[model samples]
Target: MAEAIVDLVAQGLLDEGTRLPTERALAQQIGVSRGTVVAAYADLADRGLVVRRQGSGTSVAAGRRTPVGRHLRNDGFTRQVSGPAVAIDLSLAAPVYDDVVARLQANTADVMAAGAAPHGYTPLGLPALRHAIAGRLSAQGVPTTAAQVLVTPGAQGALQLITAAYLRAGDRVIVDTPTYPGALELFSRAGAQVDGIPRDHAGPRPGHFERALADGEAALAMFVPTCHNPTGTTMSERRRHELLAAIRDHEVLMVEDLTMADLSFSGEAPPHMVALAPDRIIAIGSFSKVLWGGLRVGWIRADPATILRLGRLRTAQDMGSGLLDQAAVLAALPQLDEIIVGRRRLAQEREAVLRAALTEQLPEWEIGRCDGGYGLWIKLPQANAAQVVNAALQHGVAIAGGGVGSLDDQHLDHVRVCFTLAPEILVEAASRLRAAWQQVCADDGTTTILAAV
Candidate 1:
């Protein structure tokens, strides 16, 4: 296997800086022993074909030392497709409706005309869009105002601003055990010590929350109270109160990501965390899930002081979000309900189809709660999620391993599959996943199940 990899690199098939799969995943794919794969990787490293880092897995070494992005696989998922083009990619969970471009294009003329009128920079966001976002949040029970909202390039940009403003090196952050990989990445890059609280169906346990923050040194606590990313477990109203009480007791500032809140299957969710404690909780929202990821429009709702602090950081990063994009969002704001309705129906239907297919094809696997959200979390009977992910690529389906969303690189028996694709495509993806699971099973005899912490 090492010789084959060397040959591929020599032939320019394996590009430089490409990450290689873990020993177990490669071993499972080729039906080799883990020890043999380990030795193969060791040989590759010795021959300077691959570079091995302690935390980061092995990657093809560059000829000369060059700085790389601080956490390239921060999404917790790897996209190392070496063979044929992938048939289905479930790694990114975002809406990609056909009419999205048409909708945005319809507003281009007016938006451009408006953009041409000014210096075209609204550092805190266009006033109209901010008002619309505030109104939208108020209607959802947050009682927000334009003065408290700062438009960001996206929810991710909002996170970056918040982190830049508040977090410092060695500060502690509280998060769910298996949470958004993006948040994990940002926090890790900022050199914060992340402490993940174990979660159940109801959400993070109040007791654990109290304990994690008991030291009172935690700078922030972040939660996806509605339509959580991989797990899809929306915190119940009761769970919300319990956690909020703990936050109050600890006097800890909280960040609530409502990016997936609007996609609830029931068309109803608990009040925004900001609504319950407006002063303590900062809210991050985006149209990426409902409108389109390319929209690049999201907001941060917090106290005016906090918004101002973040705006200063934002201005340092970039002048502001694009005026045209904000105007386009303003054009779509009035039609948000109409768009959300279509998005909800699509998510519900596709989720059902994917669930049915997975149930029929891989009944032995356990599907986690998915009350709302783009992805479904699956628990396998064995701790081979990485192996299955690698094998799935060979079958032309790309899925994320459990470790993608985990704080401690745990949840090895889990995998997350997005359900935003068409019904037929989802069915085909599930079939491919089953085939991959079977391949991994046949390749290895061990069946270790790592119970969720």
Candidate 2:
């Protein structure tokens, strides 16, 4: 029983603070004696793996202690820095979906009618959705076919499949330094020796990839060139060509995460890295940003053989994603161009609002502008991002510390603030953040005063 619990925790299915099932319920479910369950829980507790409250049951322990100013918890999960009923959650980059919800509501009948599949199972996803996605990709200059597309639950699932299919224990994988936390967690859990390459506004440099590959140890490289998370910078065309040259020269496999591809508010994106190196790059994209977050539809675009292999591997996990979700996405694809236009306009406006708010409220902070993407990366005047996060939470605002997005805990003076919220909320959140910063300054015995920019 203890082993089973440990496995779940390791798999991230059971996150920290998640309460273990009651001993009686677990014993009944697993057909074990109550005393046996009790013993297992006690053993876990004795090993400092969990904490047992007198009347509250067993919960995963906060095992590793970190410096008060660092946000990276010893446990992988982002620590909840907010008080109860957080007023504004800037920590997450979840897309706002008021427009998407209205569209879905209007198309519900058509979506339902199309989802009436005879078998109700599509291991490779519904044919129409695949064709639609391929068409979209082709229009974006990637030149794809339905046969090369494999739909998954979301971008995360697509990433999981790619990592499981290609990576092995101790294999070296190169990723951007301030990459997505979920990707870092997945790669680490897969036992890959993940390495980080520093990134600038142009994205990860070709020189870094060349140097990493010169060691002849890296088997895989991952990139989020377009609308990079946390940083919100897109790669320049020159950088893309250089990076593609390095990938081809090194004979290494590349994973291109295009989850934010459609969310670009800038002009047309440079050619997709996958299109430049189709034989070596596997592209993953999702509609969660362009559409609604509730729509868990995403796809992997690769060679036909790779798609087939990933599809087969997927069957062992689940039959497939839901038919209704696919149908809904299919129904919405024709309007994708229109949808993206509205979304980009709103995102750009929100980004401007967030930038202005921060400039006016926190003038001492260094803020970078993003041509596209949903968040801003801010360098704090102080190095205690975790303290700022906790302070903001006390003022009813929640923000993410930079360590959550970094692999080596090197971004201690940075924080990621998403601009996806409504303008009024952004205003309030900025005010709360300013209050928090002042409180932090006061606690640190700094005489720095907030000045309106």
Candidate 3:
């Protein structure tokens, strides 16, 4: 029992100010004697890992030290890939929004009239919008309530609030490798030690999560289970269950980013982690993908208390999300079902075009079929992806190298290309990419050989 407490503390699982279970309760849960737990507590206290106060339960010691290191900043990578302003930019994951923009434009009058407050400063967001978002989530089986919803400027803002509210400088955050670079940057900026768990084609393995929890400390785990960014992979329902179980057992907070959940082309939306572990998981969502990036509406769904705390944190940052944007999203929510159907169809068509274009132009590249999301992860056989990105830019195309999306620089041979563009543009981008590849091979003084699929 003493070893368990130490391990939890070392891993950053048991955060400061968190009360431990009573000796009797802990002993009962672990099938150990009360005296054994008492001894364990005494040992932990002696080591200054925990503090036991009279009438107050044992809690982890504050001011524990954690090592800090510099991490690759996502914004820097974004600027590197997007700064040149190429004609067809595949470096960022902006969604295709022609249809949604038209719909919103047609209803602009209704959205403008829906706003009750003239000044448009809603610190906790528009109540009507919160209710609309909550209703949509509840319909999706997440069992959310309006009071538990807090609107933010975007999913990135919601993430900032969450990290500010829950994470301290020395906390440990576990994230999957090849995750959204923005998320990695946020965690690193928060002064948290970011640990990466390698993922497969399906997603992060649940068994790896269990091992990570047992071997290290984590204050929270962030997952993009549905239509994962960069890789465009979705987690199987069974894997989500296993991962949720691990989170429950370890008592670590879970942050689920569902920004691309509605854009799934496979027509299969797995049960939300919040549905299974409402008290533990805080889900972040945005309208940037389904509706329009310019809208900049996003939200957080969690327990009411957590929502309240996040609201306060948000209030401290800026007054609140734009009321006009909130009203626009509210006006658009009723049409969500129809909108998603169209978006999914278009996404599928785009995916197909991207696949064929890559096959025709860069036959040596290994690409996976994405069932959802906006991008394709292409593996280069020989060329360095960063070098390829630079070369592609010179050819008037921009793309994100895999190392830009990963916690470590492990995926140097891969690149992520966004397909959320017009078919003609995608085809042109692929042609330019091939040119970049040939240039890289020439620079390396190596023959470019196409690999058999």
The root-mean-square deviation over C-alpha atoms between each candidate and the true structure, in angstroms, is: 9.7, 7.5, 13.0
Q: After superposition, how far is residue 5 of candidate 1 from its true place, in Å?
A: 23
Model 3: residues >4 Å from true position, as ranges? 1-82, 97-99, 105-119, 450-453
Query: Candidate 3, residues 205-311: lDDT per residue as tens digits?
Result: 77888888987778889999999987988888888888888998998989999899988897787898888788889999998888887888999998888888788
Model 3 residue 219 CA deviation in Å: 1.2
Q: What C-alpha lDDT do the candidate models reach, one value each? A: 0.81, 0.79, 0.80
Q: Which residue pairs collide in model 3, if any? A: 11-217
- What does the lDDT read for residue 215 in candidate 3? 79
Q: After superposition, how far is residue 248 of candidate 1 from its true place, in Å?
A: 1.2
Clashes of each: 0, 0, 1
Residue-wise lDDT of candidate 1 within 1-453, one digit each (tens)? 765675466457778899999888999999989999999899777655689998899998885121212222433333443334578988778987578546674354665554333566567987777888889889888888889999998999999889888886567899987888888777765656678889988998889989999966899999999999779879989999999999888789899999999999999988877899988899998988888888899999998988888888888889898777788888887778988988989998999999989888888889987888888999988777889988998898888888767764578789899988889999999888878887887789654332232
- How many clashes show up in model 1? 0
lDDT for 301 in candidate 2 is 97
Q: Give the TM-score of candidate 3.
A: 0.81
Worst 10 residues of 3 by lDDT: 65-74
State the lDDT of candidate 2 residue by residue for 1-453, as single tens digits. Answer: 664565566546677788888999999999989999999999767645578998999887663111111112422253443335677877767686685756663244554455435666677888778888899888888889999999898898899888889876557888887888778766665556677889877889778879989986687889998988778888888999998888878788899999987778875788898878777899998988888778888899999999999999988888888777787788787787888888888899999999999889998889986867788999988788888888988998878888876765688888889888999999989988999999998999886757744
By lDDT rank, best first, the candidates go: 1, 3, 2
Off by over 4 Å in 1: 1-85, 106-109, 112-117, 446-453
Global Cα lDDT for candidate 3? 0.80
